[model samples]
Structure formats: C-alpha cells, structure tokens
Target: MDSDTFVYTTYIRTTPEELWKALTDPGLTRRYWGVAFETDWSPGAPMVWEEGGRRTADPGQVVLAAEPGRLLSYTWHTFTPAWADAVGLGHEVYEGLAAEPRSRVDFAIEPSGDTVRLTVTHGGLAPDGTIKELIGEGWPAIVSSLKSLLETGEELPEPPR
Candidate 1:
C-alpha cells in the first residue's frame, strides 16, 4: 500500500476478453461510470474524455500501454474548469487539482480459473492530495458498479451526491 498510489483488486466471474471489453468499450464504461473515453486503445494514443456532456482533451492525456486483455494503462484526465463545473467541483478545489501533476491508472486483468482478477492501480498522486482523497471514495463505488454490471447485466444505481 504505497502512500502515493491507490490499488484495488477484485475478482469477477467473467473471461479476460469480456473484462477487457468492459474496461475499454465506451458504452460499457458509460453504463457503470458516467464517463466515456474516446481512444484507439494503443500506446501513445490521445484520449478524449466525455462526462456529463462535457469533453476534456489534452496532449498529456494519452495511453501508456495497451495489451488487449492483459494490461491497460493511461494518463488520467485533465482537470479543466468545464469538467470541474460540470461535476460541481468548486473553483478552489479545481485549482488545487489542476496544480498537481497528472496521475496514471493501470488496469491489470488475469484469469483465475472461473474468474478474472482485476487490479486497478492509480499512481503518481500527491501523497496527501485532493485527487487521492476523492478517488479513494470514487474508485470503489465505480469498480463495484462495474462488477455488478459484468456479473448481473445491470449496474448499481448512482450514489447520491
């Protein structure tokens, strides 16, 4: 458990190929997380993020690795004013996030007999940064919803604001 990184592991009753589709397919992602990423899923490909009708794109927002059903990693989205406003983040909080160095998230998938082990690692965060705090509460819910969607063909209801 590194202070500057967030790691989450879960086992889902699905094939590696299906799990990979859930992670990369915009439709699947939008179902679990109200976010859609537009990219070719190749290393160095730029990613355009669409969330709540707001689009965020940056040169640094790129895929670092893509191994189909094995591994996928990419730089996190840029914290722009529009994104913050759309998500109801205040000006001060948005400024604080924009000031921090961009972080990267990696999704590793492995076959464990009848289930697939998915490990999500979000790294390069400030030890005590606001992003870390927010993601700490955010990723679990998102991952749980993802698991539900994959296993039961339905996503969990959105959490209250």
Candidate 2:
C-alpha cells in the first residue's frame, strides 16, 4: 500500500455523462452505493451524506472539485457518532481513526472510444491507515456495482462487510 495514496481504476461500457450521473445523482447512487451525496456539486460545495437512517454533514467533508462528466473530488466522510453507530464502530476505535487527517477521493472520468475510464484516487490516509484497508475492499465492490447498474440495469450484490 502506498502510505499516503490508494487508487482504483475501472472501465465502464457507458457514456461519460451516464457515469457522471451515476456518481452524482443521489437517487441513482442510492441503488449502488447504499449512500447518496447531497450537494450542488460545485467546487467547495458542502456535502451531506445519507444512509441507513442517518445523515452526516461533517465539517471535514466537502466537495473539493466538480466538473460535469469529467471529474469530481471530495473529502472522505467523518466518523460522526451516528455514523460510527451505523457502522458498528465503538467510540474509541472510531475516534482513533477519525482523529487522523481526513482523506480525499478524486474521481476522474475519461472517454475512451465507446466507454468511460473511471479512476479513483484516495489520498492523505493515516500512517497506519486503517481506513485504507476498508476502502481497498469497498471501492471495487462499489465501482463494480455502478458498472452493473449502468450496463445491465441491475446492481451487484451488497459489498461484504
């Protein structure tokens, strides 16, 4: 693992516009990501994350950049008490992980012939980086689900916890 960066890239057989909508539209995201982002999607916009009856708008999380059908970036979610409880993390472990520098994820979209190339780069992970492992396992599943949804009108099974 690169101590400060983690990256995942995938190609989807879809138009860049469709992929961008899948990533930014809350209704579409809910089908694949289980969490939907609420934001105007302009650079520096605040983002609200919602899932499992909880809504989190941690000060640390916000839209870093947004370019329709091309790129989007945002700070990682904060481990708020409600989020910790939803994810079954106790206060101590959550605090320890949350106290570290918040990470940021960049989504890059590129059109290649008939498909879009999507690259996810997560940066600023903690030295020990407990979140890296979780993200490592989670990103593939999430992206795969997104691809399936776009191509087959079906989502992949829920990512394993």
Candidate 3:
C-alpha cells in the first residue's frame, strides 16, 4: 500500500530452483521479458542490461543480494538516452526518469506445495512518480508472462511499448 513501492505476487506450478533459473538466465529472461542481464549474480557483482539490442551498464547497477532459489535483489539500471530511444520514450519523459532517484527490485521465491510463490517488490521510487507509474503497469504483465512461460513453456504475446 506504500505509494513509493510496488509489489506483485503470483503462484507458479514449478520448483523454486527452476523459477530461480528462469529469473536469472539471460535466455529465459529475454524470451519472457525481452531483457537479458549480464552478471555473475553474486552479491555486489556488477550487472549489464541488454534490451532491444542496447546494452546499459553502470557501476552502481550491482546486485544487492543473490541467494539462489530464495532471493534476488538489484539496483535498477540507469536511464540512458540510448535506452530511452530504443524503448521509444520521449525526450521529456526520459529527462523526468533520469532526474528521479534510482530504484531497486527484489524477487522472493518460496516453495509452496506443488508451486512456488514469487513475490516481486520494487522499492525506492518517488511517490506517484513517472517511473513508479510506468512500472505499476509493467510488473503485472511481466510477472504474468513469466508464469505462463514456466507453466506452458511459452510466454504471452509481446506487450505494447
């Protein structure tokens, strides 16, 4: 209920290890989310984001936590002009995003009987900010696609940009 944070939870018919792989594997993430992260996934390891054929890297974009099959957290990528252009964001919108403080996202995976419970928490956002508003619409679709891919071996259709 915090305006500065966004949280989404879903149950998937899969094991925690498998779910963790799907979240961390570049191939799996690209298939479901069109974003592939290049990182060792260890705590404090730097991460490079690949999306739409563009790579975004920064020293601050490092993994905050990496407990395989249990928890994963990282600071969000820096908003660059190239990335904004690749994603079709307008100049003004991009400027607004660049001005906001960077956010972090955490994924908690827990075993639940025959399924795993996946909870994604994105925090450090400004209340009712542009990035917050954008992710408010993005996380659900991304999580749903992730669920469908693990359950059916196929992801949902590409979402509109």
lDDT of 3 at 132: 93
List candidate 1 segments past 4 Å from native.
none
**Candidate rank order under TM-score:** 1, 3, 2
Q: List the residue pairs that clash in candidate 1.
A: none
Query: What TM-score would each prediction reach against the true structure?
Result: 0.97, 0.94, 0.97
**Candidate 3 pairs with clashing backbones:** none
Candidate 2: list runs displaced more than 4 Å. none
Q: Model 1: per-residue lDDT, tens digit, 4-59?
A: 89999999999999999999999999999999999999999999999988889999
Q: Write the per-residue lDDT of candidate 3 for residues 12-32, one digit (tens) a residue.
A: 999999999999999999999
Question: Could you give candidate 2's per-residue lDDT for residues 42-131 as a string of tens digits?
Answer: 888889999986888877789999999999999998778778887888888788777778899999999988889999999999756778
RMSD to the true structure for each prediction, in A, is 1.1, 1.3, 1.0
> How many backbone clashes does every candidate have?
0, 0, 0
